[model samples]
Each structure stands twice: as C-alpha cells, then as structure tokens.
Target chain A: MNDLMTRLELSALQDRYVSIIDNDRMEEWPTLFTEDCLYQIISKENEDLGLPAPIMHCDNARMLRDRVVALRNANIFEQPVYRHCLSGLEWTGDGADGYRCQTSYVVINTSAAGESTVFQAGRYLDHVVRTPDGLRFKSKRCVYDTSRVQTLLAYPI
Target chain B: MNDLMTRLELSALQDRYVSIIDNDRMEEWPTLFTEDCLYQIISKENEDLGLPAPIMHCDNARMLRDRVVALRNANIFEQPVYRHCLSGLEWTGDGADGYRCQTSYVVINTSAAGESTVFQAGRYLDHVVRTPDGLRFKSKRCVYDTSRVQTLLAYPI
Candidate 1:
C-alpha cells in the first residue's frame, strides 16, 4: 500500500482499538494484536529515564487474555465510561520490518454521576505488522504523562 | 472531489486549526473562518438540554480578531502551552449546504513549571464551506464534556 493508504489503515486500526476499549468490548481487545506481542503502559518520566518500570505489561496473547479476564471477573472498581480522543499519526519504517508509529491520545472518564474528567493523557508507540487477518499490533506501548492516576486504572487506557 | 479526498482535506484543515491555537498564532486564527462566522464554547450538559448558554461566543471576524487582541494584551492569566489532540472526523450533507462535521478533541495544558494536565475534552461541531482560499469554517461549536474548566480559559482550545 501507498503511504497515505497505510496511514489511513493504521489510523483506522487505532480508532477501532480505542472504540473496543471505550465501548467495553474488552474481550476482543487482544485479537488486534499478534500472538507474540508486547503490550505495556509506562509513565513518561520512567520511559524518558530508560527505566523498564511498567504499570501494565503483557508479553504474549495468553497474558493479554488473562488481563481481560481479570478486568471482567476479578477486578473491582467503579464502572466509568471512557471516551478516547486521538491524533498526530506519524509512522516511520515500512511494511518489511513492520511500521513504527506514534499517536497522541487522551482518554476521558465519565463517572456514574455523569461528571466527566480527563483520565489519562499520553502518546502511543506502536509496532504494527500485516497479518492474514489484517493490520495488527506487534507491540503497543502507552507512555502516559499523567504522573498520578486519578483512580485505580482497572481498564485499559 | 471524492469523499476520501474531501475527508483528507477536511482533516488537514482541522489539524491546521488546532496547530495554530497550540502554537499561539492567535492573529491568524480569524483568517480560517468566514467573514461572518459563529464560534462558541458550550458545556455538553447545556448543549444537550438545548440551552443557548455559552462560556465564550463570538460572531463575525471582528469579534474573533478582538478576542485575539484581548488575549494578547488584556487577558490576565498564566501562559500555559496547549497541545490539542483530535480524532473522529465525520461529516454529512454536501457541498451545496456546506459540510457539517463533528470531531472529538482533547487539549492538554503544560504549565510553566512543567506539569501536564488534560485542560479540556470535547467535540467540535462545525459547518465548513469552500472559499477561494480554501476550506473555512462558517460555524464552529465546541461542546466540552469537562463541564467545569480547571482554570480561567484565556485562550482558545
């Protein structure tokens, strides 16, 4: 695919990923990644300092599925609605080595009382590759700048 | 133009609009709108109830320009840098009645002391038309879900 077409496809992939999370379709979230994928959420401060301290990390499909199961059945937290807004889609490299891309995102959380607040603000660093199914994330790193999370982050941001 | 091309152009237009605001190019902001245009920032609660209450409203180019001047010379507030993240670009109608579209946005504010926070989270409802120069907004309404702004909104979001 051409660069513009690739960018459009990647953007759609990201939008769909966020839609699944915001719409509470957590079960399908892991399907967007490869069988051997790296999913991690780390603070920008730690990431900048080259620290491997990640708040959430999943190395394979099983771990990803386990997290989804945990969130669905084991996790205990207030159910808040999330609205994710994304922008600044930039990518380097090509299809041969998989695409390395970055996109800024902000996730807004609405409480049960209907009060909305910004839950997480950050940028996503992704390594996406073409699979038989379609574009999938080989690795996805969420580097958040919000030093202090407002509440227990049970759901993926 | 084809729908994809139109969508691409519209997305670029919106990106440029946010870049100007984030970069503090206030003087050039009015030029992106029509001579007679409407700009307003309203809370989602009030907007959903069909209330006409707006925290900030400006009609015509003169008002927009005056607001820029006020922000540059009259407004008293800390200078916080803004980074606007946007997504969900959708439009309806046609070129005849102009394209009516909605896009989600989240603005992150970085204070002078280097603290980043989600300043505003919202969606923009816009009516854009083709002009000799390019696409210009005939009307732009920012319906913010963050009902209570964190601080005095001295600049455009």
Candidate 2:
C-alpha cells in the first residue's frame, strides 16, 4: 500500500479496535490481533523494570479466550458503558510486514447508574499488519497515564 | 539531559509517584505536579474525539487541592489498597521545556483482607518539566486498557 493508504488503513484498524471495546463485546475484541501476538495491559510502574507480567498478558489465543471467559463469568465490576472518541491518528512508520501508528485520545466510562467518569486517557501504540483477512493487530500495547486505577478493570479498552 | 538520562529521570518520577499512591498518601501525590499543571484521569475510549470529560480534571493547583479535599471528605469507594508496578519507561520526545515520557505497567488492588486482583493495567503519558523542586508534571494523562471500570472512581488513579 502507498503511504496514504497505509495510514488510512491503520487509522481504521485503530478505530475498529476501540469500537469493539466501546460496544462491550469482549469476546470479539481479541480477534483483532494475530494468533501468537503478545497482548499486554502495561503500566509505567511495571514497564520500567522490563517486566513481562501485564495485568492481563496473553501470549497466545487460548489465554485471550480465558480472559473473555473470566470477564463474562467471574469478574464483578459495575456494569460499564464506554464511548471512544479518538483523534490525532498519526502514522509513525512502515515496514515490510506492517505499519506503525501512534494516536492519542480520551476514553470515557459511564456506569449503569448514569454517572460518567474518565476511565483513562492515553494513546494507542499499535502495530498493524496486512493479512488475508485484511488489517489486523500484530501487537497492541495500551499505555495508561494513571499509575493508580480507581478500581477493577473488567473489560478490554 | 541525554535521552538515556531523561528516561532514567522519568522512570524515577514514575516510581516516586507510584510510591505515594501505594502508601495511601493521597495528599502528597498531586504535589508531584506544577502549580499550572493539567491532571486528567481519562480512558482510551474517549481520547480520540477530545471531548470526553476527565474523571478528574484539575487545571491548576487550586482544583487539584479540591480533589484532595474531596478524597478526604466527600468521596467513597472501597477502602482499597493499591500496589503499583511500573515498567518500560521510554523517553518519547524532548523539548526546551520538558520531555514526554511513556511507561507501562500494572496496578493491583488489594482489599484489607489480603484478597488481591488486578485493578488496572495501563500507561502513563506524562509531560515532565524541570521545576525548581525537580521534575514536575505539566500534564499527566492516565489511560487504562479497559474501559469497564468497577463501581466508582472516587479515588485518584
């Protein structure tokens, strides 16, 4: 793909990724990534030490499925409603296998009681690849701004 | 500072910041920022549109002070305990005023009974300025990987 087309494709992939989370479809959310991909939810606190343990680190597709199962059956956070408003989608680089993109945005979370709050604010560091199925995530590292979270995180952002 | 030095400093800042939270010293956490700082607890869900209101948006010292006040007197969540494990501190950019740092890690929440689980896993997007006291936050945005948060985000992240 040309540079512009690659950028557009990457932007759409980012959008669709967030949309899956916003819609609370945890089961389908993990399918956006490659099967052997490394999915991590990391914090600045843990990442500084070169740690491999994410709050939820899934190195394979089976582990990702387990997370979805846990979210659906075991976790007990408040019923969540999410709205993703993304902007500033910037194309950072391109490679033989895929493209790199950096985008910044705010994610707002509203509860069942109608109280709205800012759940987290940060950008998506995305590594997207062109596959036979179209564009998919080879890796996605979600880096958050707050080292201290308010409570439990039940769904994927 | 050189890139490596800047990364080290940013890592130290994140470590210190997490220590304040882990110690349950909410009063001192905001002091890590400058008087004209912008502190926001946002989610990746709403970051793209730039319209999502922060769970806590303190534009200046006074507003930040009010947040501390509210945490002390008005708000209520679990008497939760946070253990922040930060890692992967990278210096993304450097400028005349400050440097932009990105780090990732996991935040674990433990109740008084020793029952613990992952509270949040996210990244810290911080703009650290060279204040008279040291590196202080000009803008700190906390973005979580999961948009479905627990009950209420009454406490600072």
lDDT of 1 by residue, B29-67 (tens): 999999999999998779979999999999898999999
The docking quality of candidate 1, as DockQ, is 0.16
RMSD of each: 5.9, 13.5
Q: How far out, in Å, is residue B38 in model 1?
A: 1.1
lDDT of each: 0.85, 0.70
Q: Which pairs in model 1 have colliding backbones?
A: none
Deviating ranges (above 4 Å) for candidate 2: A1-157
**Model 1 lDDT tens row, A46-110:** 99999999998889988999989988887677766677888788999879988999999878876
